[model samples]
Target chain A: MISFDLRIDRRGFSFDVSGQFDEGVTAVFGPSGAGKTTLLNCLAGSMRPDSGSIEIDGENVYSSADGIWVRPEKRRIGTVYQDGALFPHLSVRRNIDFGWKLVPAEQRRLDPLEIVELLGLSDLLERMPSELSGGERQRVAIARALAISPRLFLLDEPLASLDVARKGSILNYLKRVHDEFKIPMVYVSHSVTEVVSIASHAMLIRDGSVLGFDRPSALLLTAALDGSSVERFENILHGVVGESTDQLTTIEIDRISISTRHQNKNPGEKVVVSLGANQIILAPSEPNQLSARNVLKGRVKEIWSSNGKVFAEVDVGPEIIVELTESALNELGISVRSDVFLIFKSSSVDVFDA
Target chain B: MSSDASIIVLSFQIALVATGVTLPVGMLIAWLLARKQFHGKFALDVFVSLPLALPPVVVGYALLWLVGTHSWFGSLGESVFGSTLAFTWIAAALAAAVVSLPLVVRSFTAALAGVDPRLEVAARGLGSGSFRTFFTITLPLAYRGVIAGALLGFVRALSEFGATIVVAGNIPGRTQTIPAAIFTRISAGDSDAAWRLTIVSILLGVMALATHNWLLKLSSTVSRDSSEVG
Candidate 1:
């Protein structure tokens, strides 16, 4: 577990945050200027907090009252910045070996080649950072950070620079890293979909203060209702691959199966599917001959209005939030406890490694 | 003819020693000025830059006081070397180094500053301390600029005249560099010797400057390409 209560005052911005994050991926979600990066910097020991205490795995790394401060190198915390920040002069292999070689043999836990293989950077080992693509550079950065066997891994918007397709692939690699290594991570991002897809716990921060901390979906809902601008809502569902064909794959979520466009995943593999709340259409009865592949029977569990839109929480095995206009809600006579069928095309669901 | 060749060799020796002495010290000062904040930073910067603004003769006079057998350093030098340092070839090299240090520091400062500080931070995060990071990452990235800075310092040291004469004197075989030799030859009405040394000095200066400019351009390109990747 990692816990910190930090306060820092800049020229015009002040940050006061305190949270205890458990083992797993805990995301610090916020807007661009919301002090998410500042908080990460404090945790990584790059920036000192004006006053506070930070404890990692029951050891006090920082405590202002005790006058104790661990340097970044001694903290054993690995950090991956948004830009990768690889040494431009070193080859990819040398970059990964940099931190690994610094660790004492008795303390080293990870094999360097394993990290290279994990990030699929074998062929690029001889190439300099400038020779690699943006995605490849980021992968090398991740591999470099992982080579240190850091007790607490901190990433600040690692996917923010990648394109959408690249982001999805990198996110999959990140999930695999977490699952394989079991390193506790504090990931900072502004994307709700990323947090929902990867983070087991989420903290919503705004203007240097944490607005909420809970499960990713719940915090996002509260944040959205609290007037925080979530660009669009996405329903993230975790499931296992039930069956696969060349045309489609069926994902079983809490005993309810939903089909998505063909994925390369094998049967029984765990995956997370993301469908935009706005893409879901609601039908009062099971419609026949619908072109959409997914038609799940559900009942509205709750209804709320925010930012001139209506959000209906429907329990279709897993609770999913569907966005609709106020007029549509009234026209369909949708309310809490009303029976409805959620419809979405299989192509609309984005499947990612869980 | 032999005298002119000896003067050229002596000038190269003095300039090479000066550049060698100033390279490490100048890089240290540049790194400090570029990467650190301290109470006396401004004062230190001013002190380092004093040689650039003060007349070379004035700088030579200050050096004369500091090593003229009357000061603590002079006493130490006397005990260590069995002689006062002001009138020796070492004094000439010292004078050249002092006059050229500011140029080296200016170039090194710009070079070190051009490197991304974030890379250093990343190294530190990866378990390398500040000193290790400087050697492993910062130095390699800024080596081109460092070479350019050293070249610039070498050229400045080669052409050093007023200060070398004041401290080391115009000893033909010991302390007379090319510039001082040119002065001595002109004084003796040996225009041919003076003109020969002048041409050699110009050629050396142009060669060093051209290399410095090329290295600087290459360093800029490297940084630009890396920035695009980053």
Candidate 2:
């Protein structure tokens, strides 16, 4: 467990936040300039807080009352930045070895080769950081951080620099690392889809303060209700490849199957699919002769309105959020527990290897 | 060795020793100035840079006052070495180091400053101490600039004249460096010898400066490529 109550006053902005994060992945979610990165820095011991204390696993790393502070090197916490920050002078192999060699033999738990393989960096070992793509650099950064076997992992928008496809790929890698290593992580991001997909617990920050803290879905719902979330929401689903034809591929999710544009994946392979909330069309009854594919009957489990737009949660095998304008919501007369059909084109669904 | 050969060798020795001593010390001061924010920073900066702005003769006079036989530093040297440092080859090297320090510091400061502090932060996060990070990450990345700075300092030390002449008087076989020897030869109407030494000095200066420029070009290209991709 990690906990902190920190207050730092800058020239024009002040950051004051206090929260306790549990063992699983807890995402610090907020908009840009909301002091999320500052909080991460304070926790990593890179930036000192003007007041209060920070404790990790019941050990006091910093305390104003006690006048105790630990240097960043001794903190045993690893941070991955958005830009990768790989040493430009070193090759990927040396970069991964950098932290691994620093840890004493008895203290080393994870092998460097395991981490390298886990991040799929075997081919790029001899290459310099400049030679790798953005996603590849991030993978190397993650491997470098994990080599030390840190007590806590702090990721600051690790995927913010990646494209949509690369983001999904790295997200899967991160999930596997978390599951395999069992190291607690504090993920910082502004994307609701990323937070909801990876984080078990979420803390909402706004204007240098904690807005709410709870499960990611609950906190995001609260954020939406308060009109704080202005970005478009995304629905992420996991499934296995079922059947493939020349035109389309079917992915089985829970009891229902979703067909997407032809994907070059073998049968029985797991894949993740992402669809924007606005991409979904809701109809009161089944419409005949529609060009769109993959229509499923579902019930409106919940409904809410924010920022002059209406959002409804429909339970079709898996819960998917749909966004509609106020006029459309009123025209459909959709209410909670109403039967509806969720219709979307196969081209709208983005599939990635799981 | 011939007198001219001895003078050239002595000049090379003094310049090499001066550059060797100033390299590490200049790097330390340059790093401190580049990466730190502390009290008296401006004063420290100005003091290190004073030699660049003040007349070389004035700097020599100040050194003479500080390390002359009557002064405490001079007496301490006398007690340790059984002699004073004034009017010796070592004094010439000392004068050269002082005159060339600011140029070294300026080059080193720019070099170290060009490195991304985030890389250092990343190193610290990876369990490397601050000192280790400096050696492993910061130093390796800025090595081209460091070498260029050292070469610049060496060239400045090689051409040092006014300060060396005052502190270490011209003694043909012992303390006479190229510049002092050239001055002596010119005064004695040895125009041929003066012209020969002048050509040699210009050749050495051009070589050092060309190498410095080449290394700078390479460093800039590498940095540009990395930044474009990064």
Candidate 3:
């Protein structure tokens, strides 16, 4: 676990934040100038907090009261910056080894070759940072950070600078790294899509204060999937596989069973499912003989109206948020506390090992 | 050695020694001016550039006051070397270093400032301490500008006459550099020897300036390339 309670006032901005990030990826999401980078820097030992302390895995890294502060190098916190900040003077191999060599032999958790292979950097090892593309540079930067065997990994918008195509590829690499390393990471980004894609938990920040912190699904169901922002449609739901068939698999969340496309997971295996809010359809009653495979009944918990569209949350065992036009909502005449059917195709859900 | 040959060799030696001494000191001052924040920073900046604004003779006098025989440092020099610092080849090199140090510091400061401070921060983030970052990252990135500055200082020292004549005096085959020997030749009414020395001085100055300009060009190109990569 990593926790920090920091207060800082600098350059026309005041930030006060306190939170704990347990094992796994805890994404810090906020709009621009929302103290996201400042928070990350404070934890990384780059920005000094005016008051309070920081601890990683129960060890104090910074304490304003005791005048104790571990330097960035000794903090054992690895960082992957937005610009990929690879040493331009060094080759890819040398850049990765730069941190690897500094780690003492007894504490080294990763082999140099394994990281190179994991990040697909074996072919580019002899190339300089200048010769690589944006995605390639970020890959090398991640490899360099992992080589250090840090106690906590801090990533400050590692994909914010990449184009859409590169962003997709890099996100896949990040997922692979997340699965391989099992190291706790603090990822900061403005994109809800990126956050939902990798982060298991999400912390929402606005105007320098944390507005919300919880599992991404809960956070998204409340404030994000209101169709107010199209980006938040990517909501992650956690579940475990109940039964499997050739065409579909039954994943259970709480008391609900969600049928998704076959995801190569055996029964009783834990999984996380990604369901886009726009893909889900809501009905006033149970729809029979519909093309969609999965349909569950629940009461409308809440409804939000904006820009001629309606976003409703239906608590079908687990809350299923969906978006529809104002005309469709009026035609169905569904309101809060009204029983409704939540419907989506089996193939609409994307499942991954949790 | 011939009189002209001895003057040229002595000038080269004095220039070399001056450059070697100026490099580390100038870089330190440059780094301070470029990266550090302190209370007396503006005062130190003005003090470093003092020699550039003042006449070389005035700078030589200031050095004399600080290191001449009557001063404590001069007595200490006497105790250490069994001779006063003034009127020696060592004094000439010191005068050269003092006169050209401002140029070196200025060039170095400009170069060091051009480097992105974020790169150093990234280095520190990647487990390098401040000291290691200077040698491994900061120094390498800023080396081209530093080399150009050193070359500029070397040429300035090689051509220094006002400060050397005041502090070291004209002692042929011992303290007389190319510029000092030229002064002596002209004062002794040997116009032909003076003309020969003048030609050599112009040639050396042209070569030094060309080399310095070349280094500056190389630094710019390298900086552009590295920035592209970074």
Candidate 4:
């Protein structure tokens, strides 16, 4: 666990934050230039706060009042930067073991071989950083961080620089690492999908201040309500593959079968379906002859209105959220506990392996 | 030793020593200039780059004032070396280093500036001390420029004339480098030796420049490959 109450005063901007991070991945989500990186830097001890204190598991790492600033090397924290920052001169093996060798022999908690296997970096051991692909380099970066058995891990959008395909694979690998290591982490990212996929806890930050911090599922709802730069609300539904055709795949969620674009999966295989909240269309009842392939009935569980826009969560076997204008809601006379048909194109559901 | 061999050998020795002295100092100044912020930083920048704009003879004159028999360093030089630093081989080497230092510092600064400081921060966050991070990350990444800078210094030191003449004087087989020896040959109407020394100096210049370019090409190819992978 890591806790900090810090303030940074600069000529252009000031940052103020107080929070505690627990076990598992805590995604710090916000738009660009949100002082997310500055917060991480202060925690890493690279940037000292103008005033206030930081403690890692109750050990005070920095306190301006006590003049007890610890050097970054002594902080026992690991950081994976957005750019992968592997040592250009060292081989993958040496880079991964760079920090591991520094710790006393008896105190080492993780094995180099184990990390190489976990991150799938066995073949890259002899390769130079310059010779590895972006994904491979990031894997090596994570492996190197894990080698140190750090007290806490800080990841500043490790997948931001990768392409979509690479991002998906890397996200899966990150989840595996987090699950295996169980170290508390502060993962900074601006992507909503990434936060939903990996983070158990979420911190909403904007303009150098902590907006809210809690479970991702709970905090994101409030974030959508606030409408303060947390753009593009997305809903992730867990389901299982049921039937598939060349053009269509049906996913069974509880008692409902929802169709999506063709997915390469077998029956009974677990999958996750992603649909943007803005993509869902709601009607008072099922409309005939619609081009949309999926339509299910559900009673509205909750509805929050702001700025003439209504965000409603509907329970149709698997819960779905739909964002609509207040005018449309008024016209349809929809309210909480009202039965409604949620419709969306099959192509809109992006299915990924769980 | 023959005049030709003596000129060639002593010139190389002086250049080697000058480059050796300039490298570490140049890298230190370059790292500071690239990474730090402090009062008088601009003044320091101007001071470090002054030699590039000033004439070599002016540097020689300043060296003469500092190391001549009239100052504290001069007295130390006298006691340590059994003579004033002026008109000595050591003074020739010192003069060459001063004239070439700006080139070393400039190349090093540019190289250091190109490196991402975030890499160093990441290293520190991974439990690496500042010194370790520098040697492991910063130095290796900037080595191409560092070598290029040293080659430039060596070439400049090898051809030094104005400053060496002012401080080291034209003592054959002692402080008479290639340029000084060329002057000596041409002054005595020995056109053949002058022409031969001229050819040697040209060849040396060409070789040093070629090496510098080759190193740059190698560094670029490696960087390009790394970026492609990235």
Which candidate leads the pack in lDDT? 1
Clashing pairs in 1: none
Summarize candidate 2's per-residue lDDT along B1-230 as a digit string, tens digits.
23777889999999999998899999999999999999999999999999999999988888877778899988887788788887888889999999999999999999999899999999998989999999999999999999999999999999998888788878877789988888888898999999999999999999999999999999999899999998
- Compute fnat per model: 0.85, 0.79, 0.51, 0.85
lDDT of 4 by residue, B1-230 (tens): 24798789999999999988899988888888999888988998888788789888898899999898889999999999998889889999999998888889988898788677988888888788988988988988988978988998899989989988998898988899999988988899999999999999999899989999888788778777776776
- List runs of model 2 lying over 4 Å from the truth: A236-241, A251-257, A261-274, A282-291, A294-302, A314-319, A327-343, A347-354, B69-75, B78-84
Q: Rank the candidates by lDDT, best first.
A: 1, 2, 4, 3
Off by over 4 Å in 4: A264-273, A350-354
Each prediction's whole-model lDDT (CA) = 0.90, 0.89, 0.85, 0.87
By summed lDDT, the worst window of 10 consecutive residues in model 4 chain B runs over: B221-230
| lDDT of model 2 at position A80 | 92
How close to the true structure is residue B54 of candidate 2, measured as C-alpha lDDT? 91
Worst 10 residues of 2 chain B by lDDT: B1-10
Which tens-of-lDDT digit does each residue in A135-207 have in candidate 2? 9999999999999988899999999988977888898899989999988899999987766677889998988
Worst 10 residues of 4 chain A by lDDT: A225-234
lDDT of 3 at B172: 88
All candidates: TM-score: 0.90, 0.91, 0.83, 0.94
Per-residue lDDT, model 3, residue A172, is: 75
How well is each residue in A201-293 modelled by candidate 4, as lDDT tens digits?
Answer: 899888888888988867777777778667756787778999899999999988899999887679999877778888999999889999999
Model 2 steric clash pairs: none
Off by over 4 Å in 1: A240-269, A278-298, A306-310, A324-334, A338-348, B68-83, B228-230
